[model samples]
Target: MSGTAQATTAATGTGGLARTWSSFHRAITTNLAILPTIASIVIFVAMIVFGEIAYGRIVQVSTLSNLLINNAHLIVLAVGLTFVILTGGIDLSVGSIVAISSLIGVKLAQAGWPPALAILAMVLIGSVFGLISGILIQRFDVQPFIATLATMFLGRGLASLLSTQPERLPEESGVLWFATKWKVIDGPKVNDLIVTPGLLLAIVVVLIALFVLHRTRTGRTVYAIGGSEGSARLMGLPVDRTKLYVYIVSGTLAGVAAVIYTARLGTAQNITGIGWELDAIAATVIGGTLLTGGFGYVLGSVIGALVLGLMTVLITRDGSIPPEMTTIITGGILLVFVLLQRAVTRARH
Candidate 1:
């Protein structure tokens, strides 16, 4: 048609697109549980772009593979923490559990025990610790923070007693074999896409968590307890049982994380999991799991793990920044999200 008619049509199309974008933004922002996750995705993308600008090869296939490989254990830990945080509780002992469990498994392997039995024992140790914490909190009315903190010290102390030095896995051990085996894919553009069993294990854990958190009746009860434990009890829900189960799950996953980490490194030590609890908590919070409880997504926590991994990659690429800055940056991000959560909570009321 005429030039003026064409310009008018283009303007109308632009206006329609703008309205659609606005509607989508409003829908996401109105849900406080979802807003932080969306923000995390944005921040992750920005970090990736920044990394590419600084390092020139940050977008390679290997870079992507490393992101998943390096952070798989952390992802598993964060998923577990999400469960506890969803129930309006926290587990400070996860990092210590990781250390102790890994030490136990590695020590057993070094002492010539069967790999399978050693692995089982390591996991059981974590479960037993978690069960103790759960009993203290649910049966004896101990605060979650205090109970888990006590376990944290106990775990670390036990790990140190086992070995002050690193314990390396035997070269011929099946555990080491599982850790090193690669699931290699041949891509058209990339010669080889390498994935580790640890990555696959992390994926499996996430899937199971997704089902438990979103599909099960117990999961709903966990949320209800987080929202209001008194209301949940009044409604005939098994509040104490569900709360105890959440801690058990957290502890079990910490054991799982320890296994993956030790396998990847082929060694274990008393200091193996120092500060990891904080990292898991940060990932959970960044992924949109409210510290106040009752809201979160498993996939969001995975994304949060990826975000942290990306931050590390970016900081490493920029060699001028001190390695210690990573914690500072993470702390800052956590603070901002915590404030955002507070604001959203206030607005909801």
Candidate 2:
């Protein structure tokens, strides 16, 4: 009887071990299902660890505050681009829109216009440009790349026609109010636990985008279109309307980013946002948003912007590394993420 009891116990232990192994395997498979997002998160955390080890001061409250303040506009731009990208469309004109809108708004403010009105004009300008692109693409059947490229040139040219030099905002301008910070803590190590209106605005934009993308029928239609436009159309989705809205969102957000950036800097120039659209696209892609469309998160894009901002901080803190290396590092990280995305896509197929 004792011998029989010992054999039963051993059999139970074996069964438990098999169950544990099976659970582990299932967990790994489930993680791999969203490999790009997981990879992005891992890389972001690794970068933070490396930064903390190298610059000890990187984890300070002031550093954290500055990270958000500096990248707030970029976060907004990336969020906007995520929508466009998720719909299998691209907007190359966002950078140009930033330049033109900022220039126009600043010029108007300098001309004694109400700050609020100027700001509205900036957004309107961007939306109009987007509308033009949408009409060209949807109505005339022009490719997105070509249509946005033409609009990009037009925006840049118009901005340059206004002035190549920087236009400074007036000292009493209300637009600069966006840069005001409210302190949340006081300490000698990092005194400013602060929040700016610009940062708050970015956060609000992100939250709105998250809600629209996940909680609304229009959002699902956007994803369906991205998955396959032909299929989406067959399902009676308003593909054309949704597509137009995406560009308009992208453009309007570019304008919003310009306002935030201009407020922070107190100056707007024709060259204010050169190549920024590329950074926006990079941030969206790095955040685990597939280039092929159909899957992404607005929050992930925000994290991606933070990652890029953190890289700059790390590079700056390391005095030995040339500042020029920042761009190279960014490109390398982007390429690595792209390769990882491709691998995951292949595995799924």
Candidate 3:
């Protein structure tokens, strides 16, 4: 009943209320931070359900298996882009890297070179180009966009100089083994669960990327850089090395994608992978990887790639939706996700 006692009780009550509100606010913001990623997942599930109901065979084992087999290269590319994007950098050269790598890979095979040697050369070439880009950005103070753009042109030009026409792998080429398919389940009436070695390779790449981005110290360092390169440097997180590593990973994976793609088609052309860079970037963004960097998942990127593939599949099955409309639809979806990202970011702030 005393005045001082009453005042003290009221002050304590106010402090408790403030603390509760602060905790509540934190919880909401944290949820909002991951909302975009969650939205992507929901959208993907919704698409599958809608497709299956509207178009027969959408959920068939065969269709699903083929989806993975066909887009395996894109999945790998997305994984690589995830790494680079996580570090708040862009790699414009991945598509061109695919063009050049596949060109060399198929040509080498056609030349009667050992498959192992050709494959090794293909991967190493990517890493080399990645290193060049990293050096230009980190050491020479070039912007990532400009540096990567230059490398992109360089890669495409090199491929064009080598061959303008399509290159085909000989039937006896050992690299064809990558395209070999294995049936994991014998479903009835062409519904068997089929998987190709290329798909397996893509799965391996995803696994390795997940490990590197989540389990290792380097992974933590990558997140730190994306969060803030200045802070990462202040914390002694090897920002320079990690930036280089991400680009190298992206380039190397592009090469791997080329291998998978070339094996699948047994052919490569100078124009191969045209516009694929946009697809990879769109997949990453749709997967909820912040364009500004700092938060994303490799698995999310995989799902994003699948969603894009499924869109194309649906278009083909529906026959009413023009095939060319696929890009317009994809662009619209990407715009929505990007806006979603912006909204989530604003909510966090």
Q: Which candidate is the best by lDDT?
A: 3
- Colliding residue pairs in candidate 1: none
Task: Give the Cα lDDT of each candidate.
Answer: 0.89, 0.88, 0.91
Candidate 2 per-residue lDDT over residues 81-107, each given as its tens digit: 999989888889999999999999998
TM-scores of all candidate predictions against the true structure: 0.92, 0.94, 0.92
Q: Give one digit per residue, the lDDT tens place, for model 1 in 1-349.
A: 9999999999999999999999987886677567888888899888888888878777777778878989999999999899999999999999999999999898889889998898888778888888988999999999999999999999999999999998899988767754674747665565356788888988999999999878999989988998889999999999999989989999999998988888899999999899999999999999988889988888889998899888888888888999999999999999999998887788766
TM-score of 3: 0.92
Backbone clashes in each candidate structure, one number apiece?
0, 0, 0
Poorest lDDT segment (10 consecutive residues) of candidate 2: 28-37
lDDT at residue 20 of model 2 (Cα atoms) = 97
Residue 172 displacement (Å), model 2: 0.7
Residue pairs with backbone atoms closer than 3 Å in model 2 (clashes): none
User: Which sections of candidate 3 miss by over 4 Å?
Assistant: 1-28
